[model samples]
Target chain A: AQSVAQPEDQVNVAEGNPLTVKCTYSVSGNPYLFWYVQYPNRGLQFLLKYITGDNLVKGSYGFEAEFNKSQTSFHLKKPSALVSDSALYFCAVRDLTSGNTPLVFGKGTRLSVIA
Target chain B: EAGVTQFPSHSVIEKGQTVTLRCDPISGHDNLYWYRRVMGKEIKFLLHFVKESKQDESGMPNNRFLAERTGGTYSTLKVQPAELEDSGVYFCASSNEWRTGELFFGEGSRLTVL
Candidate 1:
């Protein structure tokens, strides 16, 4: 089984400050990790994904995620946060070895960037 | 290009009623998928369609839910005699290729069963 865990229900960060939303995964085989953001009244927007290349993957809105294979973690980070960055973030994972399986998503974390 | 679209942005139905939800995938996209998120729960996959054919329906909760994609262009999910637990936000997504993990999602249909 492939699953993702987001420990924090909500994260608060100040504008222009760094922010992090932690994510961990459990998979039977190599994992394909993804991060998505859902804004109010909008569908989920793809942020980035980690398939097989560099551990540090940069995505939309100046966001980035670091995949740690040894720790089974892929934590999303942004060096400088903005008020518009506030939204619901979800971490998802799928087993690459499993043929065409659907993604398993986390419970999601609400991020609030205080201006 | 227009993104995936789902009809009836919001719907309120009485329990034991029948409801049909529709989804139109992005043009040129062959892979369409259905997922749902119940209150306080993570999003769960319901099924996957590849050009009007059911590739996978393992995630479907029960037989009360029926999905059909005719002409390989649009899809519909009908829930017969909906129960209270059937209330949730149903999301539809599409991808150009199966191997590509990136999926474009719709705004989703919010269903409330009383």
Candidate 2:
């Protein structure tokens, strides 16, 4: 079984400040990682994914994540934050070996970007 | 092209009632998925369908919840005898076979079991 863990329930950042949301996972083998954002009354939007690539992956809305193989971590980062960037973020992982398996998501982290 | 669309955006029903939610995937998309988020919990997968056939349904909670995608175009999820625990937001998503792993989600149907 595969599982994802987002240790933080909430993260606060000021406008123009950088922000980081941490996530870690436990899987049997190589993992497929993804990041998604959800706004109130909306569905989850795709952010970025890490299949087989360079450790640093850039995504929409000026966001990026680092996939640390040894640490089993994929942390979402942004150089600067805006009030509009505040939303619920989720980290998910799926086992590639299983072939098109469903993604397992971590409890989402609420991001509050202050003006 | 329009994204995945779900009907009856919000529905409130007493426990033991029935509710049906519909999802229309973007044209040409062959993979459709159903997921849900319980109060304050992570979004979880309920099932996946490739065209008209079900590919995976391991995440489905019980027989009370049923899903069907006729003709492989649109899908419907019917919950009979809804339980209080079933109150949550159900999301539907779709992606073309070529984009196998990437899923485009709908706004979701919020079901409140009173």
Write down the DockQ of candidate 2: 0.64
Q: Tens digits of per-residue lDDT for model 1 on A33-109?
A: 99999999889999999998899999999999999999999999999999999999999998989898888889899
**Chain A TM-score values for every predicted structure, listed in order:** 0.98, 0.97
lDDT of 2 by residue, A3-114 (tens): 9999999999999999999999989878889999999888889999999869999999999999999999999999999999999999999887866678889989999999
Tens digits of per-residue lDDT, candidate 1, B69-111, equal: 9999999999998999999999999998877559899999999
**DockQ for every prediction shown:** 0.81, 0.64
lDDT of 2 by residue, B2-66 (tens): 99999989999999999999999989999999999998898999999999999999999999999
For residue B87, model 1's alpha carbon misses the true position, in angstroms, by 0.9
For model 1, state the Cα shift of residue A91 in Å.
Answer: 0.9
Model 1 stretches with alpha carbons more than 4 Å out: none
Best candidate per DockQ, number? 1
Against the true structure, candidate 1 reaches a TM-score of 0.98
Q: Which window of 10 residues has the lowest lDDT sum in candidate 1 chain B?
A: B95-104
In candidate 2, how many Å is residue B71 off?
0.3
Candidate 2 ranges with C-alpha deviation above 4 Å: B98-100
* Candidate topping lDDT: 1
